[model samples]
Target: MKPAINPNKIVVFTGAGISVSSGLEAFRDSDLRSVGQHEQLASPHAWNRRRKEVIEYYNWRRECAGKAQPTPAHLAIARLEQKYEVVVITQNVDDLHERAGSRDVIHLHGELRKVRCCGQHALVSDIGISPQYLGDTCPDGHELRPHVVWFGEQIMHYSETGRHFKTAAKVLVIGTSLQVDPAAKLPKKGRYRAEKLIVNPHFDVADRPYSYRIIHKEADSIVPDIVAAWLEGQRWDYGLGRA
Candidate 1:
């Protein structure tokens, strides 16, 4: 049976910054030698031209994520489920949100712990923290590739995420700089009456059209308090300025 939608639903839009406190490095902040190399390694052309390197890179990522734990921000977001229905729309490929006990999560960048058949994208499987090697194949003998949304590849679940943003009673954006497209544009889709808030240490509202209470603080330091206030039926504004 389909469950009824909650009137107090909150759609959480997150990014790599949310996982930084969990011992994972944000993509933009990674110590990669150059942005060009980072982009090349994460692109489809590299998957075709340098398959071994692609596999090794993703394997390392999986290993790192596996060793890390969820942060206070992730846990606090999960606790919001105690009072309101929570739907997480995350740009991170890591499963920290799920690991932190969030029930409904929408991974926009795809998942690091999963692999899909190159020949048939629908044929996917979870590999947990295990490494995917060069010759890994699916049931149909096709090469298994990381199920991540690489550069130039379309992001997963766009329309569905938009629908959630439109209906949310509150929209919480955490740890994102709002630099990436389409996903960055989503906060503007929220219903005009919905309470919108962003908790990020480095977000800029130079030319945004919508209204949001911007809290210029690290998610780990601030999200728990925000969640506590919301759970107690209090607004999270508490004198923080708006954007």
Candidate 2:
């Protein structure tokens, strides 16, 4: 039999930057402004006023995600499962982490590879990057919408994600600027004594409470090395110098 997985938990919080290397554009870097005035295409207001535009925009995104493969950073995060119980909490809607072999992942912003009933959010179905049209409906015939947390919509699994951060022994925050709220507050929720690290090209603590070692580097350039060190029983503070 193989060795049992370690019970110690490692919570990985990711954002758009992690998937950028996979040929997917980060939200801030994408040409969403051209879709509508001020990104209205990604909001609930747009969904109500211009449903067709919303569907088409998301369909394009889903197609982009489908064509993109998981990056090295994604695979490195998945490899963490070999030594520890890993739980990924991501702001990205793409399924790259899952495609990279991560068994447990929570998408705070919702998922592009799934759809939910307009009448009942609980009724979710996997569509595997297939395009969602205006006429598609759930079993109850309620019009289906892309299962993403639109602008101003409440995030998914808030309480559960907080619990994971609060109890984790190690927290790895990668590729996120942590500029968004609710999810941005999660790293602060980690245990004060937990070993916390942030790997991003641009990130700021700006009064957050937990002790964090910040690595100012691109995720694809640095994350695999970090994973190798951790798996070899080395801490982030050992030989990794801060930039």
Candidate 3:
């Protein structure tokens, strides 16, 4: 389905699947580790009981996310800014979208390239996803922790994101199955007149209060086509559901 383009207001909400083609794996999708490993490695329990292991896991994640590159989907979204006022709100912690030249991106899950002091929890530095040893200290002499949000941790940047969602005229969703919060909530409640399009490889496609569902397709394959067509002044005829 082709979506009409409105350069004035567009919000691109992205998820882990957008970066899968780039060689990074979203924790939920990969079979590289057992469920227990993920559970033990990503939670506060791990941080308290297995501090060393926790640090190692996040450091490994940083290395892997760092090696990954932006995919066509990311580039396509970045290019959209040339003709449209675009805001990219992503669930993935990787900086691939920014690396691909997208100017305005909101990392709801936090970023892998930064660290914070464990003392005051103040943002300490942008360490580019490098390994953070257990003894690493910030300027305030506090141990530095991965900036990326962990399971059981609170997500950042909700109010800032909500304002944009309420003001958007077009919302393009990619590669998510409405399993997560706030991210899932954005598409359902937005401006009274916004086009919401969801692109996912696996999802139960059904009509809802605010969006059209496009299923069984990867973002890398479909996003460029949609954005390109939009740039060329063409749109799909979905009739009244064109929000």
* lDDT top scorer: 1
Least lDDT summed over 10 consecutive residues: which range in candidate 1? 26-35
TM-score of each: 0.92, 0.90, 0.88
What lDDT would candidate 3 get against the real structure?
Answer: 0.76
| 64 Cα displacement, candidate 1 (Å) | 0.6
Which residue runs does candidate 2 get wrong by more than 4 Å? 1-7, 26-38, 205-209, 238-243
Candidate 1 achieves a global lDDT of: 0.85
Candidate lDDT values, in order: 0.85, 0.83, 0.76
Q: Return the TM-score for candidate 3, rounded to 2 decimals.
A: 0.88
Steric collisions counted per model = 0, 0, 4
Which 10 consecutive residues of model 3 have the lowest summed lDDT?
Answer: 234-243
Ranking of candidates on lDDT, top first: 1, 2, 3
- What is the C-alpha lDDT profile of model 2 across 210-234, one tens digit per residue? 5887877888988898888778766
Model 3, 1-243: lDDT tens per residue?
323444477888888788878888644376556345667777767777888887887787788888888999999999988788899998888899999999999999888788888886585589876678888988778888777677888788888887777777777888777777756776775654565677787866763435564646788887887788666655533332212
1 against 2, candidate with superior lDDT: 1
Of 1 and 3, the candidate ahead on TM-score is 1
Candidates sorted on TM-score, descending: 1, 2, 3
- Better model by TM-score: candidate 2 vs candidate 3: 2
Give me the candidate number with maximum TM-score: 1
Put down candidate 1 lDDT per residue, 114-187, tens digits, no spaces: 99998845698999999999999999989999998988989999999988988888889988878778788888
